[model samples]
Target: MPPSGPPTRPPTDDAGARADAYATAPLLNCLLREVAQPLDGTDEPRVYRLPSGERLLRVRGVRRPARPEVSVDGDWRPVGHAELVKLVAEELQAHTGLSNPELPAEMTDSRDAVAALLTARDGATSPEDPYRRSEQSLLTGHPYHPAPKARGGGPVARWLPYAPEAYAAFPLALLGVREDAVAEEGDVSALDAFGTAPPGYRLLPAHPWQLDLVGPGLTEAFADGRLIRLGTTTSDTWPTAAIRTLYAPEHDLFVKFSLDVRITNDVRRLWRHDLLSLRRTDSVVAAAAAALRTPGAWLSDRGYRTADFAFEELAVLVRDGLHDHLVPGATPLLAAALVEDFDGTLPAGLRDPDAWWTAYLGAVVPPALELFARSGVVVEAHLQNCVIAVDAAGTPVQALFRDAEGVKLLPEVSRAAGWERLVYCLVVNHLVEIAEALRESHPGLDPWPAVRGVFAHESHRLDLPEAAALLSAPTLPGKTNLLLRWTGANGADARYLPLWNPLAG
Candidate 1:
């Protein structure tokens, strides 16, 4: 076990205030983007006209808008998180002429979850390693989603122990599956080293939280002797930004499990179909990474293991760790953490904003485009799936992409559809967020020109005609998460609305 430390509690009032700030930004982002219109010709406090056009709203910050107020009786009255949920529900109903009772509860659950995480983090000690610190630092997640932090309305006690935001690390629950009932594909040999199993069984490591969620359902298997508990791993595994995936520093490996709770859009389970098709998708991405001219890597999802009786519920995937793929002496940082802000992740001080911006684009952009154009593999290069390795001087040296389950093949999807998805994931979701973050820090810097230059330069070398067209396109597609949630659409069903393209000049 890892060494333990004494717990210290931050004041309740301070924790609540921090939670409110973190929760409000994402809610306000949804309202402003999907339902509210900017009320032009205003100064100081920015104002917005609601969908009804009768009510007006105003907020205080630029990047993270706060202190929301609604106009009533010609006076502005502050709205709390509860009132904000109510207001969003009413506005969505008015705009779409459809109502969803579940989303409001989810919005409230998200805020309450944040409050719980803040309180837990007060008594917790952060990981000493910079990479682990970056992985766990997301307080307000998914800037555009309505309930990015919601954990399926589970009790705080049930989920808080595993939350990445609270700096959590715990040993994985090791189980022994009867040899006859074991189901596995590809290379899952890495799992065997975690713990020992009996002669007639194979070793299977499960996420403690996931096991907790599915424990009752597995009682029959345990009773019948098909599954046996084999204690926990000797070393501690820390949760990454994606909560279900845990990293064991000692082994230099990642183990992904089927988390039952809803995060962002979907119930984060390793669905049976995705697991069955994992090897093919991973192989294509691996091939693409090998062919890239730039220094980039792909962390392959090598294999998974589960019991035949509870395949989807008990499944766990093995992924490559950062050690082997990383450049010598380079430190790997989660790309999302770079945008969200974490200690020691960003450069000490960026002397030249333009050069810094160029380095970032150079490391992140080419690989995705190259994969799409050359190998017909569309890697999900979103912020969460990408890791940017920086040298000692804090310059981005290489880009590493992961999550094979999210990769799409060109022949599988129509060319036009694949291109759109690639553009959305790489440009709109990844680059736009990073650029805005850079602009927020360096107010005088205009990062878009460097972005335009990178795409233009790449267009001449790559065969993608879409790259040239993207340069002059009027708008880019932005995923409609707010509407998707409200309408109860499949999480993977991406529907986009036209967003003004910054690349278009």
Candidate 2:
């Protein structure tokens, strides 16, 4: 046992074993958190019962559950990815009284995708830039999603070149929509730098992978000269963890595209409605971000361009880069990256872990709560949406938030509902994951008290009633990803179950 109790690290160095461990942890977390009933006070291997106690499952480790086993023939038999997927399907179908053939396949596909990524990553070079490396480090994408890495069940070859985990860098496929057929809004001038259009066309850059996916359907448009291929960008755009969005380091801009494939809960597309409402939502959140006394910024979604004929399919969004927003000398790393793995990016000895975490809480927590209380803007402060800038001493000094599409505005959503969402995103999804990661690294160090201190301070500082209520609340709303997928609910229709609040006293 390696001090933190029975070793959380895998028993073997085998690639498949590592991949299985990486892939299994998230599924096991979802199974245990959302569906499984804990048989607390049970000995060594922690145990949980399925919805009806018909099946007993147990796993080692708490933060990232591992070596899942089912009690069979009065003995615990370890289960692999396939067996686990089948087990999950059986339990979900029995519990929900619904059969989801798609989710199970996605679960299997996700495991296979992880296997492919693990193999590709072994021989691939990690990005030289620290920020880019941090962004690409998420081999395990969402800690709670059942299939966080499912790449549409497509072949590895089709998806590997664009995967950030593989340190992918490729130019955007430039296209020219006939000037009269172009649909554009806001400032898409950044797209003009990639390549020139013909005399009567406007520049529109598309994700090459998305182009391949939508290519077959574009035969008619190509034949009619509504769209023309204009080669590729001279500079390569690196895909961020949100695979559809790519960062053009040379141009200092972010270009997000419409990916038809489903990632996690939704089809990763620049949706038509979301595109239409971008300005309204982003402007509100941006204003709140700008008003912050704390070190924080919102990477604005500047504008978008697409073919009027294929509105949603080829739509591309232009977003602000970090050059203008980042603190003078501070490096802005993806917040998700911190929880995933630092990969030796941070200098270790500058600050004690607790002090570093306190600085982090101050930098990240205030902005979301202030925005929610004063401006009625609920920024999705989830791990992926945040970029925390650590000073030279590895202390968090600033936070930059992005993805305007995810921000929810006040009057449009009821106050009660908005507050619920803010708590779920900022506290449960974002803080809890990062806190757990921090705790795992330095065992016996409790992080929640500092979190409680931050919340208490914010509640008093902002005079927000919701913040006070949060500390005393017995349970926090946890998004039911596994059940949501199994029930085939709309991605936007979030259903939550109570997760015992860590801050509860």
Candidate 3:
């Protein structure tokens, strides 16, 4: 891994183009999936009709749709991101017969945030290590999310310092919790190495952004000496794609904090209920990982600590780092980054796409299925949670999963529900994105055959009946993020729509 210098800023002319590209992708995704219906016999410039308002829309590309236009007054008019947001709002209001003042504002905030991120990224220095660079490179996140880049509608100054997209790394605020007021579970001993607390206190590292957000609420705790600020960490930790999680390179550890700001559907607080059940959830996944026949590993969420007074506001989770879980010589990269084309490190000149796709499916798929079938644990094997360790040749060799907070156990959810969730995460969300990237890069290559082959092979090994059904299923469940957010549904409440299954011949 070589040291990276600051990225050169693009000219003003190019900056706007880049920002539009970033902002419009998710908006178009939301529009196409939720409100617009594709027109028949369209290929070159894909066209759609917004059935609700009888408006015709057209765009150039597929994966990240661009050059949007809508037919108006007997002429096609180009819709900028702002106009697109407005169109989406109007269409949704008419289609659902429901009005939301907040979502439209969030749509604008998301666009503005993209523009700000573009400005910050210009002349910004990226992390030197490939893994760190991959983790920090997600500027246009959650391709199908309407407000993926929205930062709680905060001013740039408030959030930029902690933004992973800005290539940020900062020290955590170290706090001393009075021993009597410390609420902790499992192995939080790793925190003690950062700094020593006074005789009657325990060390608890806090994300500065979170502290800033909740500072006003904690005046009395600070005044009464239940919580003592012990200054910042001596070294800086890099913010990963999930902004709330920080990676301390020196310690090779990850710390997840409670953030009050909304990152997608949720306000990202480390809720007390989730924290209370963390140990049990993690133990189940860890045990399943330990029994894996392949090199797949689960980066365990070992423990967490927080002040009893503000448990959810101040809770911090300790997760095992990549170093220990990775195979002897493999370099780990965020799986989501591989799909996003970060650093363009994916190898070129591969004579066989089948081999590559097979290797990827081999590493990513079986573990999730095996865990579900054998251990009754449904790992959230989505791309962001999965870190694929690749060899020097950029071939995926192993898969490591994290985020115990998202894992669900058998009997908690019905077996049918568990299987549905697993297929959606593994096939729809994770593999489909990667497959599209591969197909886009290698235009002549059909990736589904390889995917189908892997499923057929794995079906014999795993006891999952859905594996067989998945092969010929006409549709798969696609999480309706746009509609879910628009309807103001609970973040955990998942509502899915049927998506055409590519695996079906």
Off by over 4 Å in 2: 1-13, 344-351
| lDDT per residue (tens digit) for residues 1-505 in model 3 | 3213334555664666687788898789878987688889999799888957568899988888999999965589899988888888888888888889898888788778777877877766666788888888787888889988889998889999999988899999999999999999999899998888999999999999999999999999999999999999999998999999999999999999999998889999999999999999999889989999877899999999999999999999999988888988888888888767777545233556668778888899888788998888998888888998877666778999999998989999999898888888888889998888888888988889888877877788885677888888999998888888888899899888889999986
Clashing pairs in 2: none
Selected candidate, larger lDDT, 1 vs 3: 1
Across 11-127, the per-residue lDDT of candidate 1 in tens digits comes to 645877677788889889878877788877988689999987778999997767899999966899998888888988888888899999999989888888998988887767777
Question: In model 3, which runs have C-alpha deviations exceeding 4 angstroms?
Answer: 1-9, 347-352
Measured over all alpha carbons after superposition, the RMSD of each candidate to the real structure, in angstroms, is 3.0, 3.7, 1.7
lDDT, model 2 = 0.86
How do the residues 1-505 of candidate 2 rate in per-residue lDDT, one tens digit apiece? 0001111233244667777888899999998888888887997589888875677998888878898889855688889988999899989888988898999899888888887877777766667687887788888999999999999989889999999887899999999899999988888898898888889999999999999999999999999999999999898999998999999999899999999899999999888999999987887888888888777789999889999989999999999999999888887788887776656433222237788889999999998888888899888899888988877666788888899998888899999999999899998898998788777777767889999999999999999989998999999999989988999999889889999999985
Stretches > 4 Å off in candidate 1: 1-13, 344-348
Question: What is the lDDT for 265 in model 2?
Answer: 97
* Candidate 1: Cα lDDT at 279: 92
- Estimate candidate 3's alpha-carbon lDDT, on a 0 to 1 scale: 0.86
Deviation of model 2 at 40, angstroms? 2.9
Lowest-scoring 10 consecutive residues by lDDT in candidate 1?
A: 1-10
Per-residue error (Å), model 1, residue 204: 0.7
